[model samples]
Target chain A: MQIRDLVRRRTPLGWKQLVHSKGRMAIATAGVAFAVLLIFMQLGFMNMLFESAVMIHRQLNADIVLVSSTSRDFASPGTFPRSRLLQAVGVPGVADAEALYVTPRDWIKQSETNRGERAQMLMIGVRPDFAAFRDPEIAAQLPLLVETGTALFDRKTRGNFIPFRQAIERGERPQTELGGRTVTLVGTMQIGSSFGSEGVLIVSDQTFFEFALNRVPSAPSVGLVNVAPDHDAAGVAAAIRARFGTYDDTMVMTMEDFIEHSKGRMRRDSAISFVFTFGTIIGMIVGVVIVLEILSADVHDHLAEYATFKAMGFSNRALLGVVFEQSLILSVAGFVPGLLVSLGLYAVVRSALTMPIAMTVERLVLVFGLAVTMCALSGALAMRRVRKADPADVF
Target chain B: MELSRLSHWYGAGETRRQVLFELDLVIPRGEVVFLMGPSGCGKTTILTLVGGLRSVQQGSVRVAGRELAGANEARLIANRRQCGFIFQAHNLHRSLTARENVRMGLEAQGRGLPPDADERSERMLAVVGLADHANKFQHQLSGGQRQRVAIARALVAEPPLILADEPTAALDRQTGHDVVALLRRVARERGMTVLMVTHDNRVLDFADRLLEMEDGRIVAARPGAAAAAPVNP
Candidate 1:
């Protein structure tokens, strides 16, 4: 009679409905959970793909990149006279600058070692002291490269290409051959930290020119700049690019833009986002349908009882509230498992690969919010029977 | 209270089939009335109308001072708390225990009575010989016992008007007689306005008044030979 008492009494009925018909409810919960897992996996893969693709840009310590107009974006090579590096340094409010070149190509004899894997490896050519803006570990490992005839390899490049089979098969050391040069393995870096050849080779400019005997005029055309710690790099980048022109293609990138550029194709092709977006849509649709049908069937199964309640003088609004609560309870029970299963599956995929598959609290919140809305809408739609069933219709 | 020109039909449009015809009838409040008729003679329809479960289409029905014809939905709902109903199926919510079902009726009126609700429910159950079965589920109890719980649920709300559609139709003759005797005693003791639709002549002795309905019309009304004067108590 009292709304509170009806609710207290009615809650057990929903629980009983869920338990009595475990077969259907279990299947329904599974359907929703499976959908959630699928979406989580898609999102994780997206993160990993972008992280690996943009490793060089992300690790580059450049605040303001000064490049020719023809270059693709920051961390990309720009062929202007070496004077541009000086021009960048002399500009008002300028502090410090470093020059390097980035290029992508198959190993000179990568096929001979059969490590010509599918990955875009970045090539950075700069001075040993210029290592400040190149590979971060370069500054730490300068002593090795200082010994002459030595080089530093980018960890990001190696992680992107080499697998456990080759790394462990060669035991305690993993080395790769590129550009007719046997670049000895110096050290390893963090995951997705490579910029070139699955192994970053750091050599002096004098040594770089010997390897590039047939290449274009290379005066370290790509400059990595360090701003006065207090100045905004993005604002400086915008100002310099507006004033600069590339005899070769050039562009400037803020650290954030560089990272977004790393996720470039994934974000742009829309197909990748489409797959994730598609998973979300399918998840919600399936959740809605399963919830609707199950609750609808529940209403039907309890028709006589509903009529009895009506006969006892319960209002239509009262019955509506019960059904609404019932649907929410079902969704909450189902969603918790759905989210857990999804996170567990994501961990498995991340452990099984060298990709950057990731999960965030925001993603869980999103899925939960969607599930609640879908369940509530489904419940409202399913209450037609409870509202319209006439006690007179029953014997 | 009275039903004038009462008749009911099934379905709509071309498929409609009339089940009851108009017949004038009267029964006073706070009295126990037994509505008897052969199976499918629309005995339940009259009870439904009086209980505020169905709208009266072709007749004027005055129940507890409200017209059954075109009654507002809100008023009709408010009418529910003033009445109690039991069905042939003993329609207690199977998911609830005996006491919870009784509490549900009282709760419907938003008056928990908490500590007292349990005690009152226990007493009502004992009155119907189900005090010990209060914790039992409807499915766990025998059919007759289930009916007793349903009766307790109906009375727990303390409604002045109580209607039953063959409350004991599922019980054996002895159990049926006991159930009716309990209904009679409860009605008289509580001063409840009670009417029950039943084909079970075996329990007719419990009725203070008998109204025989046929073809949806009340053809005769006979008061008990020793109908007691209305007791204020």
Candidate 2:
């Protein structure tokens, strides 16, 4: 048989029924697309939230970290004595240790009316010689931080920092006040902002002590440690924790454990879990309902035709194939437009919210698979009417 | 085909009203028989039984050598593949064109597609005088043309038997007569047996034999008046 005829023979009549109604098909496709958009957006936001929560930890330049035993998370990590870092360096398998200070400083920006708006800015402080940040852009600018009264600014920080960014890009210094201290923005980097901190600044430990209002000089927020080449990082972290457990007031952990601790804390404190997980379920339910209504109506409209086929010896399986074909067509047709629209939406949300909304291949495949399952389940449920079509009754 | 003491009912226990009363009938192969009856006379019930569309409640119904009295859906589907059924409503799928509807009949046979299935479907459409309208959907066709498409669908697979329930009920007198004449020519040309139920008296002349039904039993059987006359080729 010719390929055309062979294909036509296998194609069920439901496909024709779906395409024949131009208005209904468009409406059905739009409904499915809306549901898909909901799911994609929710998943994108959730992923961005998680990535942002671990942004600093992921870029940390140390294998093991020390924190205050009472520290909740990186956002509000309590300070520990700098002596703990010195003590950690004395342990075996310890290459070196550094003190890193993190605190949210008040950033003041002057608007057109000469009125200043104050925003909280997260500031990280490390020694000039042992640069702690891992980003190539920031690492390249480490020497600039060593200069007195200068700090590197995060270009991705939220709010109206575009003027300052443009000024720095033009190779001119734009000064901003941090905790009432006159600090010049010497360079810009791509470290992202987070929910807890609206913007970020990188300064030397001495500059941080100068910019931060009530920070003690002997204490640091976190302690960074590098394991010796032949030593296991986790083993050294355990050794430090064991040696410090009795007297010292520091929490010792490998970098990965620190990241997980922050992530676990965020999951417990934030509403991200409820919004994304529940949102996806709601989207699927909406899709199934819309598809069920449309497919059921299509089946009802073609009851006589289905009965005729049944009378002509079509099995229930063959007849059900028609419904399934319609559903698959709807899924594929709707998903392409939904994906295209969501790309535009992701761009809008990322720009507007300064969040890391991205379209990964894994998310794309996941949402498409979900769309198909939603439509398939609807088709299966709508087959009830097809089963009731008795050939004798139609005659 | 044969039916001996076959009966059927519609409802449960007290509400059950038997539609067919011990119907005993036999139709020979290659004969075109028309069943004439008023509404509620059980013409359709017996036709459904013979076509394996309904279960035989009592006695036996054998079509093409298979007993259908206790047959399951698979058996019924297998038996149905051997027969072509045409209905009063010209129940063509509205989404499909005239040619596609005819192709469904051949597809129902479950044998893999024959090389000429599409061409054969077109040829059958041409035979029913719908060759030019093969691509036209059901709603786009007139009443006569729709019935012609239904006829093309019924005969496309060249089954051994054809069962038609009020095949031309929706057409006018001339369309009705033309439809029956087309059916008679095709049945004779293919040597296919046909059992048709109709209330229209104008097409009675095309039947090789006629049986009159009343209240669930056959009241009269005689040679069709047209059997003695030459049927138009």
Candidate 3:
């Protein structure tokens, strides 16, 4: 027989077995879908955690950045000399250098809105023309923050203490208190809240200096360094690093390197990653257990039939092929409903949590592959019953 | 099909118990031979050994020109393909239709089936008086119809040897007679050898030869029989 005909003839046995009991098949498919949903949710949270951890780092406009050697992350940068940024100006591949003042500032929401909530927000101060934020919406709003004592509120920030996004949507400029000083929310940007900060605000450097109590104008937390087009950013970062290697006070790195640095820190230090990792493993285990139970029952139910096949000259390999095929069917059948449900769940999560949860091609392929592996493993483990199907016993 | 000094036992050490003792049987090509015995007489054991369903433990078992003693799994499978099987339980896969069950027999040959494999299944089902029930599952068929499906599945591949363990035991007397007649007719027409183990006296007339077994021994042989004294193991 041709290969196609051989394949075609042998392929329907598994499907026929699965569909023999419609209720059982439905239950089995539902069980598999539950497994897939669990895997998707856990992995989705992991993806969100990783993506959200690097949100600020990904949005930096500069190709290279200069920070204190003691700096940890965006919200934890130590102070560096402003002259270090100036020293970087003449380096090869350096396009421009601008200071970024980052500090946590306490904000008090007005009681007129029914709650006098106080929160510490990460305040980023930069010049209007050389804004450090990379998003076009924020860049477009930078010119509006040039006015003294005015700032662009992160529209994606959660919490209703000030209605930041709502006010902007209503075409109203709401004034808010930062560090016990009044500041106007003149425009809005789209950097959402992170694990380290409850909210984020951007302001002009002049207003930052005025509102920052006892802070010197000569020192800044970080220096944003843009690389010239046609010049390598890493080379410029290397040049800056070499120039500052002797200073013992500052570190220079490309934006990509800094983002990795932040992500590495989050992965090693945060419980968010740990929880998601554990959840994903648990999901896989649950999936394996459910499939094992279903496949085991299936094998048990069909023991006599398998024995008859053996007596009729069917190879053990061919019989096991039927089980494996059933597993693949269950995996794929359950995965479709699970994926559809997960997509809907993702939308709900994105809307409710205002986090960076999303479905990616890599993640879809990964979970699907894991699901198949999970079911295949269960099928293999369940083949013990198939092996025990003795034709002598059947007779 | 042949069996020589086929002494068989179960378990090991102190739990060991013998089943078949010094069993010697032979059936020539195209002959319908029936081995009639009471319960616990090792009739099924001998059938399984000859069908390559069980390993030969203490004797020689040759069927379709291949010796089964110490045969590897591949060799055993190859030998089994040359024989067809029907059982008292009507061991048809409940999930498959009668037609599909019959096709499974041809598929078991592992050789390329003819393009008219479906037609062959249909024709075989018709021969078994199950043509109208071809698309029915085992659960949907009556006991007799299920047995008929088993018959079709066994004979569909046109195997040289057919091993049946009480093929008509589950059917009514008339149905049993019809099934046995059908089996005899098909075997004679196809020049197929048959070895059936049965305790049912009602179907004895269908066999071309009969051997009566008692306590794992062939105690009586008559009507074209080669008589031999019962040998102890």
Indicate the DockQ of the complex predicted as candidate 3: 0.57
Cα displacement (angstroms), candidate 1, residue A311, comes to 1.6
Better of 1 and 3 by lDDT: 3
Give per-residue CA lDDT, model 3, range A1-395, as digits (tens). 57767665663777898898777778878988988899899989877877776788788888988888888788888899999988999888888999999898878754335345887778988888886777888888889877899888876666653455677657687777889899888777778877667668898888888789766667998888998998998888888888876797988888888888877777787787789878877887888888898889989999999998888888898889888998999999999999999999999988777788899999899989988998899899998889999977767
Interface RMSD of each: 3.2, 1.9, 1.8
Candidate 1 residue runs with Cα over 4 Å from true position = A1-12, A20-25, A50-55, A65-85, A108-120, A132-138, A142-185, A191-223, A234-253, A260-265, B110-119, B225-233
Candidate 2, superposed: residue stretches over 4 Å from native: A1-9, A63-72, A79-84, A87-96, A105-118, A140-151, A164-188, A210-219, A226-261, B111-115, B229-233
lDDT, candidate 3, at B5: 90
- The local lDDT score (0 to 100) that residue B150 gets in candidate 2 is 89
Candidate order, TM-score descending: 3, 2, 1
Task: Name the better of 1 and 3 by TM-score.
Answer: 3
DockQ of each: 0.47, 0.58, 0.57
lDDT score of residue A117 within candidate 1: 50
DockQ of structure 2: 0.58
Residue A168 Cα positional deviation in candidate 3, in Å, after optimal superposition: 5.9
lDDT of 1 by residue, A22-128 (tens): 88778767766665566566666666555656655656667765555555443344465566676667666567777665555334323224444544444445666
